[model samples]
Target: MKKRYFIWFLTGFLMLNCSCNDWLDVNPRTEMKEEDMYQSEKGFKNVMNGIYIQLASKDLYGKNTSYYFPDLLAGYWYKTNNSTENYIMSYLYSNSYVENVIKTIWSKYYTVIAHINDLLENLDKTDVHFTNGNKELLYGEAYGLRAFLHLDVLRLFGPVPVGASDGTNAIPYVTELTRDPSKLVSVTYGEVKRMILEDLDRAEKYLAADPFMLGSMYDLNNPGGNGVNYTPDDDWHYYRQTHFNIYAVDATRARFYQWIGDKTQAEIYAKKVVGVKNTDETDKFVLATNSSYTSSEKGALVMASEHVFAVNCSDLQDIINGVMITSSSSRPKLYLQNAWISSVYENPESDNRSKGGRYFQTDGSYAYYLKYYESGTIAATDMVPLIRLAEMYLILIENSTLTEAREYFEIFRQARGMDFAISIGDETARKNQVEKEYRKDFWGEGQMFYYYKRQNKTSWSIPQSVTIPENGFVIPKPKGQSAFE
Candidate 1:
């Protein structure tokens, strides 16, 4: 969910047969032709679906990447976790392997940009007769999605702004259709942000309200944490992986504003989400009870009240009803870090109880719970959560004062069965505790890293611990010249 790589896709499309990272062959099908791709409604649908398939690759958002600090900050991953050591090694050391992934991600993101550029250019050229609502929404979605990818990468690699339009630089803005991305010069990060904001501004006008706007109990009570819930409304909507809507725009705005340090905009969108409270609990989105999902399952994407955006994972059903583990060291699968697992074991007891099994204990530490790949038999599990309803609530909590923090904190906490009523007056204490819960519940979900960077808090260290990274809370400019050297 953290990474938004489109490199495999770029290579697949460009090299035609070159094996880059992971993705299928790039040969054009008999049905596709340069001119015919946008000739009809079916062609349009086919193009969009292809975009989704490429976009949804594990590299893009399915698998986390270094260009994304949310994973780094979230503390869900560490340099020492056993199940994910190979993945963690290069990241911790900034080695060539991690660099290749970053390079691929950078390339793929631009490819996506190129593809969007082509779509927009061609779509703009066509005088298509369309049903009133469909064309606008679809194009708006296309723009929004394109902007989302562009903005996300910049957030991780661009430099901070200290002056005027001469802001810190960014990776090249791959906004034009091109066969040679390497020749492109990088643009200013501020410019990229400006364009992204502009796109979202257009998107804001075109997109509709949250799809799950109808009141439901599941929406109101969907947060799964104790002492202060975040994104309560997002919790209400539920549908595994699929298309994004207005909430996606809202959440992205909130997140983007938060990154640029525009707390007002952040708080505004955060509040807008909160205002859409869900009255009925039954409508809350959860794992489809007793239903096995396939690797191809688009995923039960978040509905209005459930989530804003999420990673469509290959769940266990692809491995035949959970008989085989999805994330093996070989083929691999999305997963929670062991530290993540270790932290969620909230009920480790000498005496066994129904809920006790949920908690894990290793000598002195508690554990976390993940329903995916637990027995090593889970060859397929599709539970990769990206941006959920809980995020907004946490954003609100972060927006609160010390006294106000406890008020909302208790509201969120009580929902998750934690009895601790928080009302701390210390700013430092409030930030720390709020962050702790955020880290604990939102781990494998992929929000941990940014929360840390946004608050100017410490980065992840070891389990049951935290450390402020000396690197500061800025995603440094891409390594160039001597740095990339």
Candidate 2:
């Protein structure tokens, strides 16, 4: 039987309005012509903002792929009822609902990619005058976003990681805007890795020239300035950390290198992000304090200071809390699996992550994922971290010596209020310790499954004495993408 998939495209006439508080607050308008939309800097900004907004939709990073389904696959959570979520938790890939969700993830990500391509294709045709730095920043973010999405697509659908293996075919690395279906074809796994790295290389070069990275010297009157006029409102400097900053590009490179089994490059890039060689200068990225996670204040768990790059979504908390069972009577329930809870967080009192880090019901029947939970009105400050400092530390420990690994591991453990004196035996034991910490550190943030996939693990331990099959590691590709087939 022949299968068909729907590929979404950005219509040429649609225009988007940008919001100052949250750039991702883009509302669509059909009246503005495509040419007019890119005629000014504000228009270009709106276009870029639209890509982020689209990416944060429910099908993409907003829920399914990032938190809900992937967590189920990771065996971190389980279904309390026989709902669609239960089917997902059971790894019923053939279920129509599950298949549709996977397809939406595939289609929606490409939709964002298509819009990015549209923006890049038309950027030069517009007459808007941008500073050299601003121009580079715009292009850099566009390229970086494209690479980021493509890499995730490969992670979800491509072959298991096997040390830069060139034999397996992977998802197409889309670069240009194209309606020509004939041009879409899967590339070798090695080719996709190289393409992603090449894009990151360009992103790093362009982003280094960005004024936002210049710290205090970005002001116009300062010495060695770009001479670009700036005002408080026009200052894009503060927003730099939220976007694909230079450090985030490096963090992404570290992750990619580690996945491809290049521990040397991985350690180098990971060190750059963590500032390991320069402890005094490491204040830019630090571990979140116990209070940051347990505070009663609204939007406390966004961990704004620690995030290397995150999505600015005001409704992030609402989205996460909505998936949770707010009350005992709530139907279609979802909660952390008891097995995972016992395995990782045996001592809730000593482990700050269990005490107030991730919320647990008073009765212990359920533990709500509270990492994205914000208690008040959604604002620009609310964010979902895509890359953060803690993960960098994990990367470093994974590639370091046993003694060195223990040192790094203790730093993270102590930061979380755990006992720091835990002894380590050897390199293998140190690596196992790192993996255990990963399960606890990134519980609801969607890193565990990828961690297992990178290691090519065949089974995932679950609550009900079940083991996830090797096929479970790879989600099925959307049916209509013949190129990937």
Candidate 3:
């Protein structure tokens, strides 16, 4: 076995126009090119290491798109430039932050992707010294990460013309980063989804079936979380899990499919991850609901249950989940969106069994938002749950009938403290309720706003039914040149 766990090197300088030149230029870690970096196994590891550092960078995970956009789309509203503007404007108004965030997110992801592209180019040429299993693991993760990065870039920023007005519209695909001739090419939404799915399809097989394999077994763990001089896993573990090879990416693929209206594939991937969750203890996070605190199973499930597709909220993954929950404890924080709050709040009283099992702040805010995440309770820190039990099956049900869908969905309902009773209704009403349940259960999870917008087929509108302009759909590329470029 490798001495340490997982995967990689250092390029210390941030090289950002956003930062002062004094700070960024002073700390340039060893500057190396892809050819020089990946010459040996250790060299390849170095290149991969840079990829993880990029993932955790402020522009991407630390403080950029994923962190900012969700709040803008779902939370309390403010001006587009308001210090606390969340996801509302991008979804509701025609604004630039959304574009900026998308651009930054794209930039960060491709930086990681360029490393993968470089690794893929070089690794294939290296002599086989390690087991094929290890080699597959490396390339598999590279592909999966590449696929996911592309999907996210396209998902939030890519345009879908609801009507024929898009004949003049373009939903461009950026398979490789663009540079040379400086000309831009655009593809429609349907065409981009096709390519996105193809990347994911390659990942499904090349990627590992289990993400927590390292986390679940001795392969990943350390006694006091102190083990350096790592092997394949830890050296580049963040790149592996945070970027491409993560468990959540599988479900992310499902989500990407669902966004483009592919139910059968969505259900296939969802079933793979349904009810398989990473607990706070396992992932090293805190789950706080009022009275129940960590003791409440409801609180536990809220933090990291088998819910699908969450960005792992740990230094282990990238950046912290969010700011500390705004309370005395100053614990790690996770943002929950309004759509999620409303859906969970709207559930019938009889539905939630774990309601009694959660925490509540004595201070009178809304009982809904603070109860689960109050810093006063399980106060280590919580990761952002990009996906979860309740929403996974709920999506399945929305695409299914009362019987077929209910079989898969009840597991989530039970987990959410909902008592299962098939609400009889017209087909449309039942499906609508399923969609609503997903909305409530998944508020502020990040992906919901897009789902709601897509569910325009159902009632998935932003806070208001503003028609998203086709021109507004593109999130401009971030600043940098990559192998793709």
Candidate 3, 1-485: lDDT as tens digits: 11221112222224223223222232333443444454455555545445544554556544454434643453322233443353444443334544455555655655566556656766677773654355565666666666666666665655542442323333344444334333234555566666666766666666664334444312232322443222343333432323355455557766776766777877777665553434323431111223233353333434443333333333522233234134344323343333433344444344442243233222232222332242444442334444454455666776665677666555555545555465635677666667556555553345555654565442234333334443434344433322233
The candidate 1 region of ten consecutive residues with least summed lDDT is 347-356
lDDT at position 439, candidate 3? 50
lDDT of 2 by residue, 1-485 (tens): 11222233543222212333233332234333465456677778777766776666556666777777777777776655657787877788889988888877777777777777877877756567885466677788888887887888888788788653776878877777787765556788988888899888888877876544444212322333455333233455455656777777888888888878889999899888887221223255667667665454333455555677777664554565548535435522457654456677646667767764355543355556556654333222456677878889999888987777778878888887786456668876776777777787776677888888888865645333446665777788767785444
Candidate 1 residue-wise lDDT, 269-369, digit = tens: 86675555433433333322112121322222222224555544442234212111223333222223434443443331221111233322122232323
Flag regions of model 3 displaced more than 4 Å: 1-30, 61-63, 75-102, 161-178, 181-184, 188-191, 208-243, 246-250, 275-302, 307-344, 347-376, 379-382, 386-391, 420-424, 457-485
What TM-score do all the candidates reach, one by one? 0.70, 0.85, 0.68
Report lDDT (Cα) of residue 450, candidate 2.
86
What is the lDDT ranking, best to worst? 2, 1, 3
- Which whole-number lDDT from 0 to 100 does residue 363 have in model 3? 27
* Candidate of highest lDDT: 2
TM-score (C-alpha) between model 1 and the true structure: 0.70
Q: Rate the local accuracy (lDDT) of all candidates.
A: 0.50, 0.67, 0.47
| TM-score between candidate 2 and the true structure | 0.85
Model 3 lowest lDDT segment of ten? 1-10
Candidate 2 off by > 4 Å: 1-32, 216-233, 276-282, 291-299, 325-328, 337-340, 376-381, 462-466, 483-485
List residue ranges in candidate 1 displaced over 4 A: 1-9, 12-32, 66-75, 78-94, 160-166, 180-184, 209-241, 277-305, 314-383, 402-404, 458-485
Model 2 poorest ten-residue lDDT run:
12-21
